[model samples]
Target: MKERIVVKIGSNVLTRKDGTLDVTRMSALVDQVAELHKEGIEVILVSSGAVASGKTELKIKDKLDTISARQLYSAVGQAKLINRYYDLFHQHRIVCGQVLATKEDFATRRHYLNQRNCMTVMLDNNVIPIVNENDTISVNELMFTDNDELSGLVAAMMGSHKLIILSNIDGIFDGDPNKSQSKVIREIDTQKDQIEEFIQSSKSTAGRGGMQTKYNIARKVAEEGIEVIIANGRKDNILIHLLKDKETLCTRFIPSTKGVSSVKKWIAHSEGFTKGEIHINEGAKDALLGEKAISLLPVGVTKVTGNFETDDIVRIIDESGKQIGIGRTSYNSQKANEIIGKNNKKAIIHYDYLYIEK
Candidate 1:
């Protein structure tokens, strides 16, 4: 069977050099997706360019500051961008759904699972999901940098075998794309940190993410046991060439290191937006990490924090204020509070579904 794939096309590929929507390029890509779907391969697209499209549609005159420009451009661009994509995909007889995600979407465990379930159901129904960041309401752009991390999270959520990043450049170059002697890196392994010093910081038109950011995301997604390919989207038959030919000139981040499964990685990384926290004693921390197969006794819990319901993801912190692990809580905050520092009957975090810190 063909592998499930997630393709992220950046704004530079979807927009003209002057920052207007490139309808021709968009149509061509959509047609390629339609052809790929005919082969029975599932493809989900994470697209950018709403703000750039909006800027062209709105026809704003003067140069604006960072905050004002993003707020206005995103407000103007989001609907028009989706409408264009909808029209293009409609011609290909492919149904597309819009999903606007913020940093908080994957921060909480409940919201994370809900998102995963929603995408799974959509893919099962043969509907392609077009995901983008909610730039209008997002305030974490400075910290999150760009939607590269968002694309990785979506790929991990969908358990995709491959992630193709369609950008303007050919691939990762040694010196820079503008330089004549800059060599394209065809394969990247676990020793990517060695090439970190050679990477140059360069941003593209119509988007905030640069090559450096994409490289960072590629490294991260590759670590999750997913193959990541970075290539030029403007090239003709780019998608077809990538999937069919192994000799294609692209930076391929191979999944070399093996780790826990996708579910465990998700559980381990969900630190933000946790409803509650369990401060465990040192002995309990050791037991959880070791071969104890024991339920979390109340005597092991030193304190409980935050307001959470049953089955919410909570941090397992040690007495020294260090995070020991993350696990699904079996009881609410109030219930766990009552059982703290006592020999309780119920386990706060059961043995099953409980992941200890490594």
Candidate 2:
């Protein structure tokens, strides 16, 4: 099988100091991707620059609201951005397709499968799929955390072997990147690494996601058995060096050896789309989190909160109301409430459908 990789280029990487699209930088990045593509590597690019691209051509005379401004800018910008990608990839004789997605697309099984199939067909036809959030329609609360979150979903959905997040800075620093003493941590063991204390909570001036968001998405993707790299996109030929020369300037996330099934990987990223909550007793919580793989039976369910139908994703809570995991329920909310603490009832969630947060 060919090695499939997902490269996420952030807004800061593609925009100039004057808040305009940096055409020179965009061409440079595409050149590196072309190098990898020529080596028979399957690459999916998750790029961000549409809003900044729109800013160059249009000056808002009338004051617009935040969401309106974003919609207006991105609506105009996505077209310009995708066209640039088309011309750039055309230079390399590569056919690239645009895939704009919103959060709601991944809300159900059918939509998720459709998205996966579309990208699969694109790759099968030797077409590079350039994915980005549909910022024009993805307004306010419905939007992704940023392209960082979107890139992770794309990586998992495509079953990519690696996910590379290109940012303005070098990588996750031991301290603040602005300070001279701060240094990038070389590698992260996703299995037991703890770097939260070092992760700063600062949003980028050029994009929605901060280093914290990148770290979170990286961890989640790494847990799903994909190696993740966070590197400075400002540097020349970084992508080529990372894959070809095995460069070490970035922070690399070591993938987990305990791989999950395709269904579980999707379930892990579907936390946002869950429909209801299932509160279980201490014994149930312990058993689920324990070494033994067991299904969630109604015998341990103390309370069923909200409403959800069969096959709907539900949040699993413990006695103290902390969310321990999520799973697809086998019964509807009404059925679940009636079967609470019943010994002979069917499993509320089978082991296969459950995703426990370790």
Off by more than 4 A, model 2: none
Candidate 1 per-residue lDDT, tens place, 157-275, comes to 88888999998888999886888999888989844446787677868767787888888778867877889999999999899999999998899999746655656657654654467
Q: Which ten residues in a row have the lowest lDDT in candidate 2?
A: 239-248
- For candidate 2, write residues 1-358 as lDDT tens digits: 9999999999999999989999999999999999899999999999999999888879889999999999999999999999999999999999999999999888777899999999999999999999999999998778899999999999999999999999999999999899999999989997788999999899998999999999999998999999999999999999988987665599999999887888888888888788999999999999999999999999999999888899999999998879999999999999999999999878999999899998
Clashing pairs in 2: none
* lDDT (CA) per prediction: 0.81, 0.93
> What lDDT, from 0 to 1, does candidate 2 have?
0.93
Best by TM-score: 2
Q: List candidate 1 segments past 4 Å from native.
A: 61-65, 141-143, 191-193, 257-259, 267-358
